[model samples]
Target: MNETGIPDDPLLLGIDTGGTYTDAVLFCERSGVVAKAKALTTRHDLAEGIAGAVDAVLAKASAPARRIGLVSMSTTLATNALVEGQGGRVALVMIGFSETDLTQAGLRNALRSDPVLFLPGGHDVHGNETPLEMERLEAEIAALAQDVTAFAVCAYFAVRNPAHEIAVRDFIRARTDLPVTMSHELSAQLGGPRRALTTLLNARLIALIDRLVLASDRFLETRGIRAPLMVVRGDGALVSAEFARRRPIETILSGPAASLVGARYLTGLDRAIVSDIGGTTTDIAVLENGQPRIDPQGASVGGHRTMVEALAMRTFGLGGDSEVTIEEGGLSGRIVLGPRRLVPLSLAAHLHGGRIVEALQKQETRPVPSRLNGRFACLSGMPARHATGLSKSEAALYARLGPEPVALDALILSSAQLAPLDRLVARGLVSLIGFTPSDAAHVLGRQTGWDAEAARLGAALFARRRDGAGQQLATDAEAFCERVMARLARRSAEAVLETALCEDGLDGAALAGHELMRRALDGEQSVTRLRVSLDRPVIGLGASAPLHYAGLGALLRGDCVLPEDADVANAIGAVVGRVGVRSEAHIGQPQEGVYRVQVAEELRDFPDEEEALAFAESVLMRDLHDRARQAGADQAELHVTRDIRAVDVDGSRRFLEARVVAQASGRPRMTLNHD
Candidate 1:
């Protein structure tokens, strides 16, 4: 295996699963990134994409998979699930919550059409035990288990005392094989409804994350790779596959966090703005003192706030594969970049070569512009099981879809059918092919990875579209592509600036389009000329960063740094990061002299505050250390912090509550024998 004369130190395999691409990198400890490659992500069977990228990178490096010491991955699957409103159907068991509480924290919306069962068992804020009732749960548990893929048990004051949640979870596990998530395991916050929401989302994501892990594992096993597997968490830390599976909600921003870590590792910059542009979204975050700041107010994805700790990244639905649409009424006929991702016409053509080209060719002979000119529809290759629960119309439309790309015009019979098509797409059961920045790049000769001829044809179809004045938008494909490229650059600059302003405590949404911002970005030179620039350099990451961010420096009047291996930064970061686990315990006084300490599962009473605080710290340290080790850490380093709250009574301070927090971190454990 060492016949190639390379270093004997073990090589790490890093993979990043993104919306449009799956990237793989071979990294060495002594050297840096040895080799990297990418493959189009196969939404139908993600494992196929992983195998493709892994095989390509391994072949490029001429390395044996058996010699790999570690395989770590970072993914945007969870984030995308939240964004697109797609995941496994799960039932939420709300304990001690009235129906009215469902309105709080968007819990009801998060549940969607999922079944919810309200029970009477829960604990009070002071850990006061409530009467336990299992009659309702016993009556419905069997039937509910048969319907949903998983269950979420969220009891009121679960963070204060998880006894009720634990009971419900145990009961569900005894009766069903479905996974269960407890609210207390996710967050220790006082917001019961918010915690419930997080738990429900976590339960929904269980099957999705499990599939990803199992897919990767099966692929590795068949390839004879025996490395320890790890996954990147939302906070840019590595965790064991098992740990990640249980708390998939914590991986909401896993890909973005990995990119930030990669940005720092690649540039060695202490302070800068890191922007990672992917196929479906652009994530922007600030780096200060060699580390990115964590969002104190939990991570918010697709408008739902969850108690996931992650980098304070601002994600925008603007990327290479973002759907391109027209704003017809504007005088200039503004081109809008997406809030929705579409299969790039170039990529779609590559997938179904003759069908796509033939359809586009036929579209050119039309006398008038058709709304569905460049659009194609096809099944997403999802399992037949995913197609369940669809409405009659949706099912009918879905059944007609096949492997080949069908022109949208030919697929739908009427305009009324469009809503069903959208619903199918939202459910991840179907895909839409249309013009995107990637297709525009291909038309302009900026990219050539896919079917350039198909891109050319798709661009031409869009070019014939009529604007507000009923005039042709452009003379040809190349001319139309130029506008698309310009629009992307302008939007990317605006997104970065808006994130900066928002971080500076301003209304960035409004300021992004303000006169001053426009003047600064445009470099306007007039009387009362206004100027603004980023305080720090921008570190651009992602596979398309180099291609798209080349002009960002001039636009922002700031330095834009695109590292040499920026394309594979997320994968690189996935392998280089360390395992981190956090554990917390609470100490509160139920009476003037009696104190109660809430550890992982035990609630013990203490006679004094000092005794309670000491016990809490010990419990947190042990829990975090064990958890970190289980998460793939070896000889982990540990730290602790205590926050004790007190109240002033009659000019004298009195003990209120004390919180003990512990953190453990270390590099992921590697195998002793690479062979």
Candidate 2:
């Protein structure tokens, strides 16, 4: 048995649901990975893909369902949704704030027409309460409940005292069935607008994460795997599925964090730059002394900076399935890859074989290529109910779309139709299918498992497009495919370098594109030869890492390590991770000799500074220990740290404030025997 007292080789199942694929791995601590499998992710019904991968892995390992002791999963679904600006609508309730406050922290931009209400309620820095006005909320609760999937409550200075926020949350729960997220529950920091923004996002993701957890639970039950299901948080720590459902915003970098953990475990690397290339986004982070760095400023995804504590990772929108576009009005016709993803033509043809092939073949035979030669649109398989809030134009365009792919040239006869089509795509009701890096890989034979014929045809169509100089973009299909692959490599290198430069406190974005940096990357020779390189190797992880990162080492002037089973690293990390929880309390002096201690929704006054500090630490430890258990830890060990602030006045020390933090960490509880 291991030190935790469980069996040494208990079989564990790990699952990772990503933008394009769902992967599963069966692992044993004593034996390492037993079996691994992958399946195309089905967004409409995630269970389909989950079952496909899990069943495949189980069959490959020759293991019965009941033998599994634990099941853990990590996902990029929440991250992708925010990056793509797709989620259920939500209502924001801000107490003790005005319309002017929404302008802070990009909160107004993030709201984007979603309902927001401001009321008179809040607390001071020393936990003094402000009268809460809830008459307006009570009157409009029923109407708001009908329009939004969830609600977010943020009382000004809620971190000082959560009484107002809790009161509003309870009121909402008593009136409506929708989930309500309180800002204080998300963060104890004193930034009201930022905390509210975080709570707003968490509210938006409630239904999405809940659906995934519910689906996973039902699927596992059907398979007779009665193991405790855990979820990987953005910090690479494990938490109960229920915990994740309430705070899905914390899962923004879940998949990338898991990949970092898996990379460290697989390569045993002390320090390396890890880049994980997935279909929708490429996640990059650094491992310092075998640990991923935590972002003290909170995680940022899409364009909104949030208050979610996640790994210090940069997510770029350049990946295998990134949309391939040619820069307009440029004589050289330089290619541009996405900040947006597309369903690759190869995968489309593989799924809808004859029809996809016929469409591409017909497009290839055209005398002159149109701008929309190889583009198609189809339903994204989201349920019809989610198609609400569409404009008349959007509804009309959405009506014409069905399960089958429709060529954009035929579907969009006028330029006016383009905007509606884009709106539909943004709403997640439709997906655009086009030639992407994945199709380029297929054409060049660097990747497989999809229709190469469709890729070749799509490449041919793209090659025939004209540049500003009236010359063809490429001589032939293979040449165009090669150029596409080369661009992907160059972009991937820049992404890695940009991340490294940022970590060193430089302007990574601007420097990565600077002429000197460009020359260094391209190995340009001149009278003044320049060179730049990384101090350590780069660990590349992803299904297509081998193909995409083949030349990354030479470009970066460093070694690139591609470990075995790197493709399923996220899943592996999910199973091997431990559960960790943290709680904090603060002691602030409202006046001389009066210490006000605030922790876990309670505030009390103490005459002595030492007494207040002791009370804060005790409260923090008790709260964190219970939280650790609820987060899935079997038996957590607790640690406390103190940060006291004071100033010397007249050669005597005066107390200002004290912050006490408690941390609990332990392995997840595993089943000892089949029930």
Candidate 3:
């Protein structure tokens, strides 16, 4: 798309992996975005999704993948695996730390099993530990020769010296040739158990990530995309294919990061609330300085908590696919929505001239698939009956549905609700299946979702005149519509308040005010004022933002910043993020009856302390730079930060400690990468 002849500048291809789809983009230095495409995500073979996106985009641009210089991929595989608990067989290897240390915050009860192997050898606050316990360590390595996919070693104070951790690592490499990760290698942070958990998570995700990258690289190859691949991390940084595989956990928030990228590209507004609408859900984030706000608590995957820094984005189940239901006693529908993922039940319900889920509930309850069942603690509070009329597929999916009581809650945590619920009808779960997400979108008078009959049914259903109810209908459809809207308004307002800020102090009024302030002053809303009541204007985003948000925006009195390509917001956002990484190390000592400290790099064995520090600094800095460059960073910088902590241990005062933490970042590589 560039006017320049032969376009000498590198054309970066960016790929973002999302829950539902994989998005690809061709970007240039000066010409901005050239082409983009989206493909449904493949949970089984992730590369297929990337390949689909690549082929679609290249087909549009009439370009070959080989011509692209570099490829950067930001994915949700690690995040999803953790969130979904789908990572393959992995073992946790804890060193020199107690079982008590394993139960620390961020990762409590998340490990599949208790860690194996306990050694007496570990460093003190200063990386100086009792002499090595080589004999015991060798025996431990010998013991783990079989099952483990990889190894993670977290010693008492490896961050200080890493000698013990590295030596043990060397022993691991010599014995098993398995992927080895040491606490000191990843980050120099304290908390042996927390560090061990991070390593365990990384090890667990290795194979999955390797497959993802390999699949991605191969897919590009099929499309003649011979460029090297880069992957995005949770911290909004890019790492090499090799690096990302070893640390897949870093790229879990790739979807939101990409959206942040798109937001940056279109509006150029750094401070604002960026709302990304997907077919199934809405993702909201506060961006300060052109990036999504980073959560102070760190990245949370599935229920397992990890300290991978990421944008502070809040996700909600409220999306286009959210179903609207009415209760029998109420003048209108009870307006049941999610905490559970639906499969276009609304569309299916509409086509059947009834609520499919409700109807199914009326008929019988069944278990959903293993994939889905575990996510929800309970279904919609409905009791399950024997499998009866359902097929294995249907039953499996249903068993996963949990009890009817927990349905909405489960939906909130997953993507099932946003699925084409009408698919249920197609599969004959319901007597008369209806429209899908596509169908509902069209019927709702939106731009996306191409179900024609669905559109008709939705319009008629919402209008309350569908199915030829005629004059015989119990009540006018308009009255029903009004009632439904009233309930929906209340639910939407409540959801927004609860999600944005927790209950208590964060009332609807406060939320409305915050929303208004965030949107108007911070450029989050198209409307200048927040709606005090449901009657006020409300803004919206997603595949249908262009078609639907305007009216809502007016209601909420806020401005809307639609992406240049609003339809593929999630995909675009997936590809629009930066690749980054963070690491920290610590050491402690007590000076003259007082705890005084210094924290630094592990390679302090050099003759000059400054030189050792500088070299160690260079090690991480250059690693980050090289990592950034391999993915095509014209320029990059290393941000090295140091913190000193003085803690009261016992009574004595000696070299109590020192600690160092650093992060290196570079320009996001451009490449159509998937996985």
Candidate 4:
């Protein structure tokens, strides 16, 4: 309200980059969404997709870039990295950890042949430790630095006191130019191996997240949109881009969390089950009391559990681009969706023009369908260095492949060559293009963004496939496509019910596959009638939610809410959240009246418990306040909570330990134009 009581425009731009598409929306405080736009995600150069979406949204809203006061983004890049098992290779440095500890928390499996260095220095439960053997680290530091892109340091009982981990981090920093992640910085939990695993993951993600942030920043600057950039955390909270760059592990579920936030805001529902389907995964979570349920056990992504607080989401690798495969060994063959995403044949055709269609048509001329009738393989957008560990056979086959899609039937010379190709696909160096739900949608006329003729040909090839009893699966291409859609629907319903049953304290897999539950879900008619339903409504979110979740209501026996602007829900959620920063301090009593408080990096002893607690709280509050402000929050509000553990001894309470947590939260500050 300058001189005439008129409020200046304060527009906000939100962007979400998923595995398949990038969505953008323009929003305002006075009004809701002004406009929304989408573009295909370009893996080779993400900034291209960001520019396309942002430019289109701005043009649609007819708003000047200068009027945009804030720009925030959410992405599945970290989550996808975990799922696809692709990231910068890093070495894990373990202090005082035995080989047996590797078996705990799937640490050994997560390491997956990565270099691990074990040393003989760490603290005990009381944060009392032996002196670190700096000479041991020094001997191997130079050689290890050359092989790994980053380093993860974790010492036993580092949460109680991170002195050893800090020393190792400094040691590595001075020796190498690589980034180093300390376990204590990621989590204050007591589990050493789990914390190490989390630290390793964070170290792996540093480069990926940094690239995304830099790309977004560059695009914003290029467009002359000089707003403060923000990034969403896994718990549906906002943080500054700089903060996110440091702790990218907190963003593993950033996109799904944003969808949940968007779901609640769009439907105004206090309690419901929110399910968001993307190209690679289907994320399902419960919303209670207008907030998403937080997982007490930390977030588990791609089978690895990290100490990052996130929504209690059950994610299944079932989505639009999920690779379609036939269930083996059954006379009546069944279709199965994926744990891996594949480019649809129709999409491949559209991308490569007539080459893809010519190959498919040429294969159709055969008397019978080959094993790889509708499958093709191509190199993904990874760098050449990523193809380092290929075996002789794998290397020979890979060398023959070019950038264009090659029909699998034409590429694989013998049966033994198939395994090598699968390995390449698993390594993310290559992608297998095949029949998927998206191709089925194109065949059934439900989608039209790609080549429909190629979809029809692919569907015809799949329809020609024989079951164990040697019978045609479908009468025609359209019928076969319908079966694909039905298979996806049934699997999706099971995924939802499985999650619900788990929440109800039942074995999700067993209950979901039980005969009784199956009858109830299908509404079967028999002498014994059974009915199963969800207690809360189901909120569907995603670009294809309306198309895929149309029958979800009947399956769950609840109202299926698909709010308007569902396609851009993640983008909307990215902008509507407030910035939050939390800090904690642990206070313990080492002896009678001798209190020790673990501050940021050091432990100090005080004469009494009150003095220690006060000092710790003051430090934490000041640190959290500064962080929240630096995280783009203005006029932040601070709250403090203390969890003091004590037991009644005779007549008085005996103090054991105390944890002080400080949280600072505020709406993001908007940049005003100075014209």
Best model per lDDT: 2
RMSD of every candidate to native, in Å, equals: 2.0, 2.8, 9.1, 2.7
Candidate 1: which stretches are off by over 4 Å? Answer: 365-367, 389-396, 412-414, 672-675
TM-score of each: 0.95, 0.95, 0.73, 0.94
Q: Candidate 3, which segments miss by more than 4 Å at Cα?
A: 1-8, 106-108, 131-143, 323-332, 345-438, 454-541, 569-634, 639-663, 668-675
Q: What is the lDDT of residue 74 in candidate 2?
A: 93
Model 1: pairs clashing at backbone N, Cα or C within 3 Å: none
In order of TM-score, best first, we have 1, 2, 4, 3
**Candidate 1 lDDT, 194-295, residue by residue in tens:** 999999999999999999999888998998888889999999999999899999999889999999889999999999999999899999999999988999
- Clashing pairs for predicted structure model 4, backbone only: none
Error of 3 at 435 (Å): 6.8
Candidate 2 residue-wise lDDT, 213-320, digit = tens: 999999999988989999999999999998999889988889988999899999999999999998988999999999999999999888888998999999899999
What's the candidate order when arranged by decreasing lDDT?
Answer: 2, 1, 4, 3
TM-score of 1: 0.95
Indicate which candidate wins on TM-score: 1
Q: What is the C-alpha local distance difference test score of candidate 2?
A: 0.91
Candidate 3 per-residue lDDT over residues 1-675, each given as its tens digit: 333332546667777766556787776666667788888666556787788887887777666555687787767677667765555555555556666776686444666563466676776665557666667656566656676677767677676566677777787787787887666656555667767777778777888888887777777666666676776666555667887776676777777666666666666676656666554456666666666567766677677556567777666665544544433344423345443344443433333343334433422234321222211122222223323466555555555553232233333345644343234333323222222233344534444433344344332343332222233212443344344443333444444444445313355345554545444423444445433322112223455466434433443344555656655544444444455555544433322433222233333343333444455556656566665566445466668865543455588432434445566555654444323
